[model samples]
Target chain A: MSQGNMNLTLKVWKQKNKNEKGRFETFDAKGISPDMSFLEMFDVVNEHLISSGKEPIAFDHDCREGICGMCSMYINGRPHGPKQGVTTCQLHMRSFKDGDTIVVEPWRSAAFPVIKDLAVDRSSFDRIMASGGFVSINTGNAKDANNILIPKYDADDAFNAAACIGCGACVAACKNSSAMLFVSAKVSQLALLPQGKIEKRDRVLNMVKQMDEEGFGNCTNTGACEAECPKSISLENIARMNREYLKASLT
Target chain B: MSEKSFFLSSSIGKKISMGLTGLFLISFLIVHVSVNSCIFINDGGITFNAAAHFMATNPLIRLIEIGLFAGLILHIIFALLLTLENKKARPIGYEKINGSANSNWYSRSMGILGSLLLIFLVVHLAHFWIDTKIAVFTGKADKHNTFNEMKEVFSNWYIVALYLIGVGSLLFHILHGFQSAFQTLGLNHKKYTPIIKKIGLWFSIIVCLLFASMPVAIFTELIK
Candidate 1:
């Protein structure tokens, strides 16, 4: 009640490990600052739990700055919690009113198994990348920026696609739990440039195959991934990947 | 993967299949609505019957009709398979997940909408297609007046209402399915996608309204 601070309740998902069933545990977050990032508020709750001789609530975070793609967990049914175009680390407490019960959960997908409370193993993305999500560039020197001239429009689009942080929010947000947005972003970032053009065909095919093998669902073009993506990755990337896949399969 | 298996195995392949078949069905609807709209000429059943008869007996049309049935069956099969796989992809669901927070209801409900349309199609074929095919093939009806048959069918208020409901389902189905087909085929463009969506929206509304209006018009005796 003093200034901008308020009390809130959080129903955080708790799972011991990958094989265990998860459940939500309620915690009182009192006198939380309206300006605190969502993660910071959770930090306060964890501190409280640890001091009370309780097993501290475990979640994932590396770079609290949102670019690490380490911060994840659904807050109130959204990947990054109700906020558009921001990661959980960037989501501020002011977005929710005091006395509101916020439900927090991990990204639920067969491809993403929970490692602990609020932290699922996103290594499925890594496996997908290993399939064909790269340009086989010779590693010697950093090429000059203008060595291969890319049109500004193409560069911007490639850059936008490259902005995906592998957070799995797209998969988390998708009703089918589709990995199309993530896989497509990986495919588009390379396929747009000449360096990545050599592998465009195989890249899409292999990545898509790996994606399916990982048990991720097919995209129904719901646009949920693009809508909930913290990085604002475009659905256009999925379309680009689809085009790439067709071209690969046909010839 | 081999090219054969690529189209048959990949996630993209499944979607591409869905999109392709969905577009084919949409094209079928275009022809269907156009042929049925002959009723709007207001000359009773003559013009409509001629068009219907030509469609029923034409060899090339019959060939395409087979393809149409194939496409619908394939569409439904792939839809069911994809929906099942989609459900499996998330064995553990969000306890408090918000679907409306991200995507439109229709976009997520393609399976449900498609199922409704399929149910309608069965009754529709029973009412019109089977009888006409039997009559034509039996050589008992040289001048098949399907329009009179339609008129008779629509005279029942419940049938008219059911037709409207079917058309209503078609509207939502097509609204999402139209541009979704383009996206699945990777045909999106920054310049054209917005235009494609706009066209899709109006196309769904107009096509469905026209189809719905036929039953309403017949029931009200406005066209006959």
Candidate 2:
């Protein structure tokens, strides 16, 4: 009832490990300051649990900023709280009402198994990246950055695509739990760049093949990923990746 | 993946099929709408009857019609499979979700729109296509009259209302399906996609409006 502070109900998913079943456990989060970040609120709850001699809820997060994409929490049906274009770490308690019941869970996808609580094993993304997300070049002397003479437009697109933070939010927000947006961002980043063109032919094919192998769903162009994406990754990258994949498959 | 499995199994490959078949069906709609638009010739159904007769008698058009049916069947089957797969992917859904915040209703309700269109198609085929084909094959060739069929079907207010409803569903379906097909096939370009989307919106409106106008015109005696 105090100004700038709210009592909230948190429904958080809890799991012992990847092999254990998960369930939602409710807890009272009282007198939370509006300025506190979402993670900070959870930290308070964890501290309370620890003080009470109960096991603290486990979650994955490193950088409290939005850059790392490690704060993968689904809040109230959205990938990262109710806000658009932000990671869970960047979400503040002010977004919710005083008595809001926030439901938090991990990314639900066949490819992303829950490790424990809100943390999931996102190694499938790493495997897909390792498949063909690299380019080979003989290193000699450091060439001037302008030696390649990249177009400004392509550079902009490459930079935009490169902004993907490897978050599984796209998979979580998607109705089909597809990872097309993430994979396409990586594909577009490489394909749009002059330096990444050497392996473009094999890169899209390999990445998509690996993506399918990981049991990810197909992109239905629902636009959920682009909307929920912390990096604002466009669905155009998926189209571009599709173009690349088709060309690779045909030729 | 094997060549067959690649097209049948992979997500992108399945989308490619949806695109190809969708485009094929779109092309069929243009032909169908054009042929039906002959009703507006206002020549006492003479021009429309002749056009319909020509379509029925032409061997090449007949062959292409077979392909059109095949394409339609494939498009429907793929749509169903994709819908099922997508449904299975999210076995447990969210307690609270906002669909319209990201995409339009038509894009999200493709399966539902498609089902409505399917119902409309079945009624349409039962009313006209089946009757005409039966007349052709049952040695009742002289009874084959598509113009009279149109006049008779539209005379009833219920049938006219149904046709308008069907056209309405078709409008929403094609509005999303048009550009979505292009996006799925990877035909998107930064420079051209906005243009494509605009064209798709107008195309859906114009085509469905034209078709819808036919039923209204006939029912109102504007064409008669």
**Candidate with the greatest lDDT versus the true structure:** 1
Worst-scoring 10-residue span by lDDT in model 2 chain A: A129-138
Residues B1-224 of candidate 1: C-alpha lDDT, one tens digit per residue: 22235576678888999999999998998899899888899998788888888898889999999999999999988998899999999998888978898889999888888888989999999999998899879985565778888889999999998988888889999999999999999989989999999999999999998999998998999988
Tens-digit lDDT string for candidate 1 (A1-251)? 57879899989899999999888899999989999999999999989888999998888898888898998888888999888999999999999998999999999999999999998899999999998845678889898878888899888999999999999999999999999999999999999988999878878888888889899999999999988999999999999998888988898
TM-score of 1: 0.96
Interface C-alpha root-mean-square deviation, candidates in order: 2.0, 3.0
Report model 1's chain A TM-score. Answer: 0.96
lDDT score, candidate 1, position A169: 93
